[model samples]
Target: MTTATPQKIRQLVDKLELEAALAIMATVEHPTAEIDYLHGFSLLQVKRDLPRALELLRRSEKAGFAPFWVKYMQAMCLSNLGRRQEALVALSSALGIDGQHVGALNLARLWSLELLREHLPAETTNILKTLERLIPIQTATAPAAKATGAAVRADTNSDAITTDDALMMALLGNPRLFAAPLVPSSGVSGAGIGGTISAGHAQPARHPGLVAVSERLMGRRLTVLDLACGKGGVVLDFLLRGHRAAGLEGNPTYQQRPEGHWLALADHLHLVDLGAMTTGFGEDRFDLVIAWDLLNKAPAATADRLLRLVSEQLLAPDGLLLAWAPPGADDDGDPDGWIRLVPPTGLCRRRPPVTPAELPVLPGLVPVFHSRPEAIPLVQHPHRPVRVVRGRNGLPALREEHRDDLPRVAVISVPKAGTYLVGHLLKTLGYIDSGAHAGMGGFDDYRDLSPAEAKQGGPHLARHIGLSELTRLLHGGQFLVGHIPCTFANRRDLDGFQKLLLLRDLRDAVVSHMRFMADAGRAAGQDWVDIPHGPDRLLRYLQSTGRIYMQMVAGVRPWLDVPDMLTVRFETLMGDQGERQAAATIRALSTHIGLQKPPAWNRIRHQVLGQPTKTWSGQRSRRDGLWTAEVENAFAALGGVELNVAMGYSA
Candidate 1:
């Protein structure tokens, strides 16, 4: 086959007649080994036919072709086919056949050593001897589109190439050669693989932070050249981040796409040949060039050559290079001597990103941002909102919080309305071991104190007893029953700690509050009601028909964060005290706070368990059916659409 000159290849590419160029090459026999390999490489660039390129190389290998170059190309194909393990195998074979093949050596180092650090740790130290040989390519100086192409031309000189036919055929024919060499066998760790007859040493140790950074950068836009992109994790990171990225691997098996349903997902990826990457891509084509873990695996000169290739062809002008490898030793034994190869600077200094409030600081590399957890405030009842915060990490803190608040009782009274009915029931049921409050300053309703009396006492007691103190008391094993609004967000100082929220349906709640205020004669204050005369009118008119449904919804929001809470509807509790049902829920709360069920089960049962849904309608001459229909339609527009009719509310 007549070997196509670089100018000829350029001309064919310009003309968009790549196939014709390949046909011409087929006609020329025993073209220089370089020509044969370049011919296969050229076909790969223009047509992007990995299979065809593999076949061409296979044929070349059979005809006493360059085995090292052929095997390298085979690795690229295998990597593309999603056969990373196979690709690594081919690269190793190529290196074994011709240790002096710098491109293949670097490619192997980058893939097995750098990119796949998560899988291989021994490759870190392998690149140390090769450090000084790395010459920076003039990629930054070249114009964007021309940079990569220029490097390829420089590296593709036929006279500079070497070949090994035995290595090439082995790579081309064997699928197993494409797999990674680092995979652990049976019971052995990945590092325990016995070395080939000559090359044996301890496996490399991969750095965790580098692996994490690479994972994070995956799917993000990275103008990267894997130099040895092994299994495509680096490129995959860019792709996942919705960036246009590609890779170059020398193993032909690495370049070939695998056969699987997943092939459909890789339709847009471009896996170019290692030689062609230098030969094909324009200068400064990539924004960032990465050569992971390659330093320790290859010879010094080859390592230097690969770095030069990266500098000249891959790196973009303002691009950053993320070089991942093991720590290097300096005068002392500190792990700080990690190195990077740039222009005159040689190695860039590493710095960690600053941390912000409520967030952890990023280490090693400069960070953009960090995140942590937070707590938001919530409104449980009309009066108090709930704010949950993390308290002590153990039960001991809970015990301290509850030690002093035990036997804490909330005194509730009703005037004319039925609020006292609930208080009376609680007293009757032994939930609260106290009588109703004794004062009445104003108002007309249940046995509750007047508005004037409640104001003076409520705030004073709240300040003195403080929620924090109460929480502590509860945590220490005390029984607390109260007539409070369930609003706790207002008391910022009080931590919920080991607490259990108790709630009942809005219908019963409004009815109870109305009566409690009426009996107290406004001692609790008109502030408790949303509107003037609301408590009594609501009690008389809509108590049983869901008239206060909106208030019910508003009340539950605060307790959302309380880890230990038990909710009961008044009507449901009116049924039976099912030991299994109520006990199970109580047990869960007890377990959460590290407590056993209280011995006073029956006494606490009536207060904490269910209650009957109390319905109310005064003596009236109106027929039950008429009242039902009217109440149903009337409350439907308000809050009691269905139950109003069932009770007796008329339209």
Candidate 2:
């Protein structure tokens, strides 16, 4: 084979007269120039001629050269050019065509904050969540510019930690936008992200005035209530002081504590809802009501209701109300005027009394002694008010910071009687060190999460796990248990790649679900029909129930097999062996995860079973005549037929 010489090639090119040949070759229309220009634009991008490249890409696109990567790169060029809004539009268009394009996802997550700063100022949460979704399915290798709103990429294991921290900081630091900060209740000194934040050396209060006030309040079996107990800081203070403590907070994450028998701890601490209490439980229930500095949180109406509730329900017979106003609250002439506690009688005496905010504003409320202990200092000094509530002003500024070097254990569960009981037992039995449940996730839900799914949804509730608590556990080695919905969103936490696919007798499950839902009032607008027994509302029932099941099963597959899962029949769960097996299983799980069972678990279980003829459902139980039939049909209709057969279903 002979190679053509340059002179011969030139002679051939001259003979062809390529440009003139092309002009003569196609008198008809053709997209040759547009295609050539697109090729050129790609080369320019490779050569770093971003502006010219982008312009060419725009021209190509205008000429109908449709390609996914081209648009995606154009967006990248726009972003590099600081045209964030334009970049977002280009990326959005690219994503609309291909939702999971990594380049677009990276761009979205990397520039989310910057894009947000440029566009919708109010939808910050939406933007952050969007970025949270785009976090590489792969682990990060190194920390990137979190402060500058750039995507942080670190090693996979470390990335989990870094991503979690950045999310927490963003939410907490920017409270104006991210209204809900991910905060956990308490821990065995380790469990979730908040625990990690508490891991550092304790900072003694530099404010001598604040220290004195804290110490003075340590007097007596003080019944203390911490309002809006984020990360349980004040609650921990009460525990340290050996005082009777309780906390009131609206955030669901706080109730999802990592400590074993967490609620038992609450009972021990004397925490109760003063507004929602049984009659004859106790009169003049509390000794002190402390509504710390949480005034400027939300709707003013809601704030006033909280304030008034504290004044009435939480105050003791001769109790004192401790309130703190930020420095900004004192802008009006009277320093004491910032906080005015008026008695019910005093309020009534006023000519047309002013309406109090919050709820159940008592008419007889009256203001008591008002004092300003100028000596107190805050954690972070602002020109703001020193928020501290105590009876004394003389004490040490700092106390020793205590760190608990415990293993990490998470127990997942949806809201159910046995779920909480199991969580209690795990802690008490010394099987698990720490656990949390918002009663949101379903039981046995975490047994099927894949690495990909875990990364996607983990941070949504990552704060529930104390980063400090997990300090000792290996990355990916730390344990988590949850009852989150087995839906597409939470399947990330499932074990392996698939669920164990547990099957219970459909009739029995329906009965149990009915009883459970009635007790919980979880599903909205579910009322019984008027009949001797009852008309079956099985459709709505199965819709919600099956929806959750399908979501879970769909999310976990190929990576995990059904054998790795466990499906306890509802009847079995309540049977004689049920409690024993459940208890034993919890014990086994704790041992597997490295944790101690809480001592209170057994006691709680015993108390639960000891009650005779357990009328647990009471008036809520609506007998359903067709429940069994409807459930049977539903099981056959859904993917449960095979499962039912696998579980040895005959009918």
Best by TM-score: 2
| Cα lDDT of model 1 by residue, 550-650, tens digit | 32332233333333343332333333346655555544544544444433445566653333212122211122222344434444444433333322223
lDDT of every predicted structure (CA atoms): 0.36, 0.36
TM-score of 1: 0.24
Minimal lDDT window, size 10, model 1: 369-378
lDDT of 1 at 171: 25
- Put down candidate 2 lDDT per residue, 1-651, tens digits, no spaces: 123332332343345333432333224234343433443343343455568757666555534355455566567677677765456556655554465544345555455444334443463555344334423343333333110112232234321212222222222223122211112132112222222111112221111222124322221234555554443434534443233355444434545543211231333222223223222123223444554444333334444455555444554433444444444333334433324333321211111111123211213332222112211111121112211222122221111111122333343332222343334343444333222222121111222344234223321232222222222121222233433322211222232111222234544444555555444443334333111233355554554455334223222221122223443332343444556775664444444544454333355566444232211333322234655666656655655555444445555
**Each prediction's Cα RMSD?**
33.1, 23.6
TM-score versus the correct structure, for each prediction: 0.24, 0.28
